[model samples]
Target chain A: MDVVLQQLRHTYAAPGLEARTVLMIDEWQATSGAQILLRGISGSGKTTLLNILAGLLPPTTGLVRCGGQSLYALPEDERDRLRATTIGYIFQMHHLAPTLSALENVEMPLVFGRKLNAGARRARAYELLDSVGLRDFHRHRPLQLSTGQRLRVAVARALAAQPALVLADEPTAALDAESSHAVMDLLQESCRRTGATLIVASHDPALATRFDRVVDLRNGALHEAETL
Target chain B: MYELKLAWRNLANRPVQTWVTLTVVALAVALAVTVIHLNEGLQRGIIRASDPFGVLVVGAQGSSQQLVLSTLLLQGLPVGNIDGHIFEELRDDPRVALAVPMAMGDNIGGARIVGTDEHFFDLRSSQQAAPAFQLAEGRIFAADFEAVLGSRAAVGLGLRIGDQFRPAHGVEPGLEGDEHAEVHTVVGILQPSGTPFDNAVLTTVNSVIAMHAEALAAPDASTTTDHAAGNDHAAADLVSAAETVSAAETVSAAETVSAAETVSAAETVSAAETVSAAETVSAAEAAHADDHAGDDSHAHASAGQVTAVLVAPVGFIEANQLWRDFYTGAEAQAVFPGRELGGLFDLLNQGQEILILVGYLAAVMAALTLFLAIYSATESRQHLLAILRGVGARRRTVMLVVLVETVLVAMLGALVGRLLGYGAAAAIAGEISRRSAIPVAIGWLPQVEPALWLLPLALGVLAGLLPAWQAYRVNVVEKLFPS
Candidate 1:
């Protein structure tokens, strides 16, 4: 699946200030199985662009097309179904259900899709957890696992549905250097094995150097950087 | 199915809050159901016990309530006696199916001694009904001085067939020499009728008259002394003297004086003529004694008085006529126990409605508790619910999960509460029976009560609404980002 954006623009309304444009992109595209890094400072619209591409937020004025279908042209529920089967999002905070075990948290995305029974869901969740090298920690909850281990579980969950696109917003932001590198490696390796297009939003230049492509968001415009 | 599992997991996550809410609901349901059961049971038991006696007529000399209580309930002071001829008139009437005459004044071991005849055993409330009295052992009294004990009377007094006991002059159990010198033997024991009759000792009307006659003939000194005070020697001396004169002679003398006073004043006779009349009564008494060997009706000389008459009319029309006839007469007052019971229940209905109102208020409080618990839980789980939405759960699914949790708790509370209600009802019924000797069975199942099943469910749905709506509208972006 290929992602396309055509003059995408988004705005936010404040109580007293005039409406402010948060994001503006002119003609940016990425093909399937491509690992792209989005680098930007705070308020640079790095997360906003990722949200638009995932169909989680519609652009205020412009078009977003993932695969061949226009993402914003569909109904809200249809977009949700599309996201469930086609896109997996990893948040900065991991956001694992505190009460669920590691294996159950990884099984969450599969519960929303069809063609998986209880046994099959468990089996697929186990396979994903093994891929992340957290198979022995399946019974541990999010609070019991280290930050790196928690992010690894999140990566496993993001790939559980075998989505075409994997979106990560600062997934390794709270991890130490060694743990951050290890998490990044696991995420990249999982995406490669599944042939999923990976887009990670972060400010870390050291992490950006490992991706196939890196784009910088500055002053509401996209800038292409040299690939590693 | 997954939504239900999630709801269960969420509830299980907070054990204390969940259990406290469940206990509140269960207590409310139990109280409401117990009130309903007890009210229904008391009404039913009273109606069953009151249905067997069609009407009662007592002497017009005293309170009607007292008469009905004494004659039908075997509980109050005996009203003054009416003419025994009233019993004959009711028995001979074509509209009257059966009439049992009662003469109640004495007691044996705290149990009422009811003076009635053999027809009393065969009497029924209506023409189509069967006899109410059935013997549990032995036979009905066939001769004067013989007694038949009711179920409770036999149990309470611990008397069996061939057991002899004397009656006290009044209704109280212990009055020393107030007990008549002549002893009456128990002949039979009646089955439990669940009526006032269950606590009465039955004998021929003659036995009542003979006992009173003996009590009146004895000197006043011995009558005041307590029989339990070791006065056996004095009581023996008096019994020997009374036996020498015979109970028939004493009863006959009392009746002759009563008879002579009824004669016209213009036909007044001399003292010598009274003595001659007394001699003639003595001869008649000897012949009556000889005839008593074969006859079961003893002491017929005292057939002039009775305490009350239990009249069974053919139907409502006959009953009304009897009521009017006796009401107008100067001798006795007639009453319908069913009508009186209806009036009593009418007075009770107001209290019952207030009780039910309180029950409903408690149910409302339970609903409030449920609403608060769910609302608070939703507030704490906003992030978790937002994550669920982010994972592709629809708004409808989130709302359904909350609703299902509320309903499950309500269902569990109702189920357990119904059992507790039944247990409470049984306990109350047992207490009622123990105190009043009136058997009250626990009423029908709680499921039979619509309020018991539907109130909790309706409240659960109503209480779940706000929280469910809140869950439905949770914003995944705001909760996830918060920036």
Candidate 2:
């Protein structure tokens, strides 16, 4: 699925201050199976743009079309269903349910989809866990795994339903250099295997060199750079 | 199903909070159910004890309330006995359908010995009802010393047919010298009537007179001996002949006996004519002596005095007339047992209403506890709920999960509380049965009260509303990505 943003804009209002635009993107697009990097410092609206692309946050002015469907124009529940079936998101903190095991967390999306029986869901979850090199630790809870392992489990969970678009916001922000590289390699390799459009939001500029395209957010504006 | 599974898993994760909330709900439900059971059971017991036929109790001039209480509830002291002639007057009156005389003030092994006649067994409080007394075993008292035990009395005293027991002179058991020397034999056992009658031992009025003969005898030696010798011979002859003769015939026969000759030949009589002559002279002397005996000794062997009379009028107008007649009479006071019982319940209803109020307060407390448990759970699981929403659960699903969790807890508490209520009522009923003659009926099921379960369920659902709304309004973006 292709992602298209047409003159997208978002604004936030303070209690006593004027409303300020947080994001303004003019005609940015990414093709399917493309690995794109969104790079920005803190408060630069890189996360904001990723949220809009995920259909999580609505744009104040403009249209967000993912796979030719107007994301914001659909009802809230339909958009949620679209996100669940078509988009898999990875947060900066690896928001896996603390109570559920690694395998169970990966199976959570399948529960909401109602497309797989319990046996099929478990089999798919185990396959995802094996793909992420954490098959032996599938039964372990989030707290029982190391930082890199937890992030890997989150990545496997994000791609559990074989979504068309995979969004990772600062996926390796809290990891050491070696762990970060390993997590990024696994995430990108999984996305390539699934033929999913990969969009990674991060402040690290060096990581942008590995992507097919780099969209930089500076001064609330989008700048597209050629793939390395 | 998934929502229930998730809710269960969430509650399981916080064991202490879950158990504390459950215990609070259980305790509140138990307390409320107990109060309701007690109030309802007491009301039912009192009403069952009340006679619907409207019996007018005529006793010696005294507290009519006390008279009714003693006669109907079998509680309190008996007001002084009225003239036995009052019973005959009521029996012969055209307005009176049945007039049964009662002679109380005696007990055998904690069971009250009610001195009445055979007519008492066949009598019913109303024309539409069956006989009030039904035998579970054996038959009614046919002889003076034969007794009919109530169902509970037979069980309590461990007496069966032909078992003889001496009764104490008063209503209480275990008086050192109050027991009568004459032993009465049990002839029958009555079925459970769920009334004070279940704890009574019934006998003929002649048995009461025979038992209290020594006390009722005159101070003069000749009069005492004449009555005793006459009663002994007639009783002996009646026992040997198996004759169902009236007390008047026995008295007339006893008056004809010469005191000296009857006493001398009482155990040595070999000829039937000599025995018949001795019985006649004894009967003539007894009647002559009874005429000389003053009213001071109202416990006379003859039917001259009685504890009270149970009078049933022919109609409402006749009943009112009888009541007016007895009310204005200088010798006795009359009371409607049903009305007196109603007044008694009216006094008890005030306390019952207070108990019901307390029960309501417990239900409210239970609701508050449920609310707190769910609210705190929702507050702590906001992130988890937000994750669920992010995973594609709708707002309605999340809300339903919370509601289901609350309702499950309430259903469990209500069931447990209902069981506890029944247990408490049974224990109380057991204690009451031991202390009093009245047998309180313990219900097997709480069918008498639906609020025992329904109120708790409603409260639980009501308590879940706020928490469910909170879950419905949870912001996935804000909760999952807190700044």
- Considering every candidate listed, which one attains the maximal TM-score? 1
By DockQ thresholds, what CAPRI class is model 1?
Answer: acceptable
TM-score, chain B, model 2, is 0.76
Q: Model 2 chain B: which ten-residue window has the lowest total lDDT? A: B233-242
Q: Across residues B34-127, which tens digit of lDDT does each residue of candidate 2 receive?
A: 6656656665676666553246888777777778777766776666676667887887899998777777746787777777766677567578
Model 1 TM-score relative to the real fold: 0.77
Candidate 2 lDDT over residue span A1-228, tens digit each: 788889888997779989989887778888989998988888898777777877777889998988888899988878777666778888778888887889988988888777789999999999999988999998898999988888889888888888899999998888888778888898788789889999999987669767878987888888986766
Instruction: Report the TM-score of chain B alone for all candidates.
Output: 0.74, 0.76
Q: Which ten residues in a row have the lowest lDDT in candidate 1 chain B?
A: B229-238
Q: Rate the local accuracy (lDDT) of all candidates.
A: 0.74, 0.72
TM-score of chain A, predicted model 1, versus the true chain A, to 2 decimals: 0.94
Candidate 2 chain A lDDT trough over 10 residues, lowest sum: A77-86
* Model 1 alpha-carbon miss at residue B105, Å: 6.5
